[model samples]
Target chain A: MKWFEYQMEVDQLHASDALKARLLAMQPDSQTSRDHSAPAQRGRAIRFPHWRRWAAGAAACAAVAVVGSQVLLGMGPAGAGISTMSMTAGGAASSTAAAYDAAAPEAAAYSLAENGLSARSAAGADSAVAGEKIIYTARLTLETKDYDAARAALEQALAAAGGWMENSSESPYDNRRSLSMTLRVPADSYEAFLAAAGETASVVNRSEQADDVTAQYTDVAGRIANLEGQRDRLRELQAGADTLADLLDIEAQLSDVQYQLESWQGQLDWYDDQIASCTVTVDLREVETYTPTGETFLERLGAAFAEGWQNFVLGLAAVAVALAGLWPVVLLVAAAAVAAALVLRRRRRR
Target chain B: MWRVSQEELYRIAVENYSDSVYRAAAHHCTNPIDAEDVVQDVYEKLLRRKGSFSSEEHLKAWLLRVAINRCHDLSRAASQKDVPLEETMPAPPAADHSVLDAVRALPEQYRNAIYLHYFEGYTAAEIGRLLGAPTNTVLSWLHRGRALLHTMLQEEIEDEMV
Candidate 1:
């Protein structure tokens, strides 16, 4: 037979009687009285369709208006700048003088050496490391009455100065509370936020230390460069490997070299991260005690029980609904089985 | 609330297309149970999704796409696990029926195109869209499937007569 004829025959022969019966049983009836009554049980609540449509239309218009305003606002500054520049020469001079006056105090507050560590180091020895450029460390201790408020203010100052906290803790001792945050304030802002933190609390102690690792850095760099050259030679050997055995041998050697290189790179990166950013340790204490608020035991227990019960009921309801949907198929199967058995008994008697 | 009811959709799908999915899967899968599994999975997915299709053609096309994807996914997963095919498959009708077996055993791409063209009345272009392939690729598949089918079927007829 032709392929098409065979395909059609296969389709016909394989048509599932059971599937067809099930599909026939599932066909929806028009104006089905029993199904119509089910929807009526919910109480027919009419909604004005136009109201929702109008609301959606209004929302779209509002969104367009907002976008239009943002575009105009973005263009406003550039437009204003060009118009001001094109104004009378006398007026332009007055505007320039006013702008400079407004910018002066902000510029004065940030010293070039104080705002950038590279700039500070280039000026001469870093102020904090002037005497001992090697083996120098700085320690600061601050005391505040309100630990949280003092910590928040210190954090804000650190963020404004592009600084980071290394370690911080609140210690309880008698009626007085204390906080100590080890902060790595920007070398430029080290003097500024430190002074500000001191104003927030009392400055108990201040110390600075520096350590130079120039020789160590140079030694490690030389070793890494030598190893990288060796590793590159091994890679060339691996690429030119003629036999599988030689390839495997080269791979083993390459693996060892790569491992050592990665270890050296990790150590170098750690050293670089530490050298790039200076570390400052600050110890702070509150002058007053910290007292935490309390909640009743029964209230906490009751809330936990309520949440557990709600979850349990929801899980049970989901399972019940799933089983309910499957019940129709189950019932249909049961009825068919009973009918089949009855027919079989009748045929046997005949 | 909708023009086509879920029950009607379910009925039409099960009656007309269930066996097609089963036969397609049975050719790819080893056993009737797996074939049944594929059909159940396809129908359950259709029921879960609320698709208001424009016509019966759209609905049938959607179902076919889902079935083909499911079968392909199952076949790929089966291959990955290094499953021995026959353990999951029924024995062939006999050596005499080699052609029918071989045609059924042709790879998924060929089987699908041939089946849709001959069984579901799909043209090569229609098959291309359904299979996410070019029309020429689908035509080649159909031609290849026919050649494979003819060889296998002829072998089976000779074996049966002997």
Candidate 2:
């Protein structure tokens, strides 16, 4: 038989009607029936097996449990560790105090020796050297009944103490007149200037601070000495160079050493400027009556309530914005729910 | 996309595609019982599918692809016991038994390609897409299947004449 004849014969082949009817009568399995209850469930069922999904969920939960346990283990000993650290810190503090006490007499002797040594140094010979570098600053906030008399008295006191006004501002507002000035004085006269300035006005607040920069000054001095020594050695090497390359190499080393020396010199100059002058900020206010600026308890409570209400409104607006962004998703879910309900209702009618 | 309810869609799919799926599965499975199982499985897959078909042709193509895959899975199952094809397969009508037997005697791949091409009237390209093979491979299978069928049927005819 020809190919077309064979094709025609095979095309006539089919299953019996009884067998087709039997297959048509078959219903889905129990698991499939449960899946058919919801469209989302049906989609999930086709995606993966139930056991695989359960295994994935279990793995995720196990990971979370592991991480949580690790966090708990880390935090559990933190309290004990803090107490232990505090005890160690206290022990270190006592030891430091003992060491400071033992070294007190030696420190005094060293200061005297350093004063003698600095008197002979080039920078110290030009200006009187203190035993240690200290930047003294004082802030005096005063209330005065007579603004002009207090200001004149302060200027006289500043001149007598060998101090100059670095900055001065006078403000006349409403009924009050205030004068604020920053004064720079010789370090040796800082105490005398402060005492005299205190006498010129009724001192309401007085604060003095002394920052000792002896250690920083000594460190910079040592670095400068080291760099100078290197520069001298490079100069000797440059004098003895036999070849052009050797001379060039020595010159580069000398240039680098010189640059470092200049940088250290600049830092030393800044330290000298700070140490030579003591800064004093004096605020003299002319007051007709004394009025406190501190807020009462009732005022604080009212402010807190206002802040809380503002935060609540901001939270509500944030939620409204988030809901607006998700409107499309919300609409899709609503449509799905309605379709599911219709399917369920039709099944009931059937 | 289908606008009908899921139940109505399912009924329509079964009414339209059940016989064709069963016939194709019977060609592969050899046994009527296994073929029916395959038919049921294919329908179950269809019912659970989340997507809707673009057209009736698309739905038919999906059903045929799924039916072929189910038949392949059944054939490869470790627990499957080989039943004698002559005993388990229902005899075709007396006029067509010889030709049917000859067609069934071809190798599994050629038998599937031949059945899809000749019996279902699918082109080689369509059969290749359904079977997840290249079109040229389906064409080769068809050539070999036809050669084998012609030889087998001719020998049977010669024997009957003798």
Candidate 3:
């Protein structure tokens, strides 16, 4: 047969009426519930639905405008700079500013002075979610005068706080030793653990971060529930399956569903483990001097002067070493000068 | 550049491209039921998709690609069972049976080239984009598929079957 005949033959091959009927009955995820409730609407076509989108957009725009205006106006009346905002003690300023708005912006700003400290009040918002799923992690860089004493005290502190070294490595550089460790402690003992670590060795630099995984935990939990329902339904279908082909198909689907169920369950379990314990990576180094926090202005001035004098002495030593390193070149120049002098003297005598 | 709603696009796909997708899948599948499953899966995917197609042609190509990929997955999954093609495949229309059988026998790579070039009327370059193959490769597949189909149908088309 010609290729034209072949095209005609293939064109004649249409999907069965049953399959088309099934396709026609299918609804997308967004419309499934609504279509199922009103079967009469199944045949109707819903276009762009502009009004719905416009309504949602207008609501979002209004929300952003309201929040933006309040924050801007609140800052103007409060007369507090960005630096002061971080040092304020409480959320009183933010809350009142958000609530009262233009009616009494000054009253809202005054709450900042009442709140006391601004240092960590910004991040204190998560204090409300204390019972929620959060993964707390901290990184600490520490220094001590003696390596053996610091290392022993570090282990004692970890034991005191019910923490254990999950991983550790120690190395020596320039005759001084440094140790790095990942420690895991119960979430409840996290603050105590930090304090204990500070007592063991001076914490040079410290940073802590909290990952709020409550939303993800709930989402994965929901997926696991749905997968469990699917697996159970598939099992029911399997028991009732009559034909060999039907049984095989169901078995394949069952395995797939089971695999997905286990995967989601595994994820939820991991979240639980992370929420239960906190991971802190600590770096300990042997230092001759400690950089203490909360120093007086006078002490800082004295330190600055001492550092300058030390730098000057080091600079002179560096120059002297450089001159000594060029001795061979200096000796060659001196020898040339002597030979030239001897030749000049011989010519004068002649 | 004109925008069509997702629901409208979906209805259009069901009406226009369903048979083409079914045919594409049927060529690769061992049975018509499996082909039907692939077609169902292709439409379900279109329904679940979060983004809109650029145009009707884009939508059609997406359907064809998805159907072909699903067919490949089904074949891979059923490789161990090794069902006979003649027993599972439904009988085609009486007139041009030999022609389609010859085309189906050409191999998987040739089917995309042959189907797109012959039936869908896509250019060699368009088929390359659809199949994710180089233009030269698609051209050669079309060339080789045409030659192979002709050879397979030569005796039947020339005298006895004609």
Candidate 4:
């Protein structure tokens, strides 16, 4: 009744010689037959035909050609006509002055042309603000004796500077009474707001950054204009389509172009919003007593050790939860290792 | 890049591994015809795979895994009906009938474990990896399978004596 003896018995039972020969005789050509039949069954599930794809591609290329011509024409002397519709400096100058009177003298001479947008300074008269769209951001960390009073003062400062809080959070832990807020203010008031915020609490840290996004914004705007022209051309083609297949093909192109236009339009709107407002991050914390900046080396070492122990316990808990989730797989692997070791040991003994 | 033509590679694979794949499929399938279908399916998949094997052992393991999966798929197919083993296969010679019948009558999982462990000489862990079961589960299958086979064979011998 030994398993090895029974293994011998079963090993003797195999496919008949005829079946073995037949299986071995199978050729790779059988796959060709299956492949040929598979497409026929799959064709019903396919939405687009070969000819339809080619037709759609051709229509797209034609629309692109039309849009390309329009962009080229607009960039030439005829571009003045396109610029006149959106870039009347007189109206923009007045609006800019009304928005922020402090920067009015600089905005009065701003102009938009084929190259890009630029601003001319009145006092220097020779100096010109280069054609660059700059987004400004400021980070301010403050320490105050009263967290609530500091937070209230910061909100009032934002309102006075024509800014709105974009996001805000208060720490839930009792040991650390802190408030964090992100505010969006008119670009002209960015420095003024930072100065006002400094009055609310003692400034512990301050950082300012300016990012140039002129090229990206201009590229997205140009793409949106091109896609809009393409959509219009596709609509015209749809009107001229005579056959059902031609109509469907044109409609598909129209749908695709419209989707692209909407996506680029969203990007343009985002750029406009970002360019109009500067971001200011404020961090306020309550400090009971003012402590000197200097600390002993031993004190720093003790703090480091405490932080390390906390992280170690947190890491151990994470590992325990992960292992609990994969217990079945763990058991299988453990059993496999034990079985493999036993098999190797038995082989050696023999 | 493969130096050999696809046709040449297909020929070499069939010549080298077709019998082993067919035997594995036959152990699980209800009849020879179904087993043949599983064999064809496995070979077809092998031909269509885009990746090249690292070595001969890798190729053999791939073929066995695919053959086992194809057998499972064929057995589970709702359109497939069980055919009598005698109808699909010619009667075994008198000497091998007792053992063949007993092996074939065992449950599918136990039969696969026994065939792979003993006939193929695979260790329990290797069989576990192939069947996607724990090593202990495979060992349990082998143990219960042997106990069942011993009882069946012993009963047959006693009947013959009677």
* Highest-DockQ candidate: 3
Candidate achieving higher lDDT, 1 or 3: 3
**Per-residue lDDT tens digits of candidate 3, residues B1-162?**
639987788888888889989889877765687788788888888988998888889999999988877665555445435654542233332355467766666577786678878878888888888877777788888877766666655544421211
Task: Give the C-alpha miss distance for residue A4 in model 3, angstroms.
Answer: 99
- Highest lDDT, which number? 3
State the lDDT of candidate 3 residue by residue for A30-140, as single tens digits: 333321121222221212236788999999999888656554543342333222333331342344333233323243233334333132232234233333455667777
Ranking by DockQ: 3, 2, 4, 1
Q: lDDT (CA) for every model shown?
A: 0.59, 0.66, 0.69, 0.65
- Candidate 2 regions off by >4 Å? A2-24, A27-350, B1-4, B78-97, B155-162
User: Could you give candidate 4's per-residue lDDT for residues A164-233 as a string of tens digits?
Assistant: 9999988855444888899999876776888899899866556555544555666787788788889888
Per-residue error for B124 in candidate 2, Å, reads 1.5
* Candidate rank order under lDDT: 3, 2, 4, 1
Error of 3 at A344 (Å): 13
User: Cα miss at A200, model 1 (Å)?
Assistant: 63
- The residue pairs found clashing in candidate 3 are A86-A118, A87-A117, A87-A118, A87-A119, A88-A117, A88-A118, A89-A117, A89-A118
Over 4 Å off, model 3: A1-131, A306-350, B1-162
**Top-TM-score candidate index:** 3
Q: What's the TM for model 3? A: 0.38
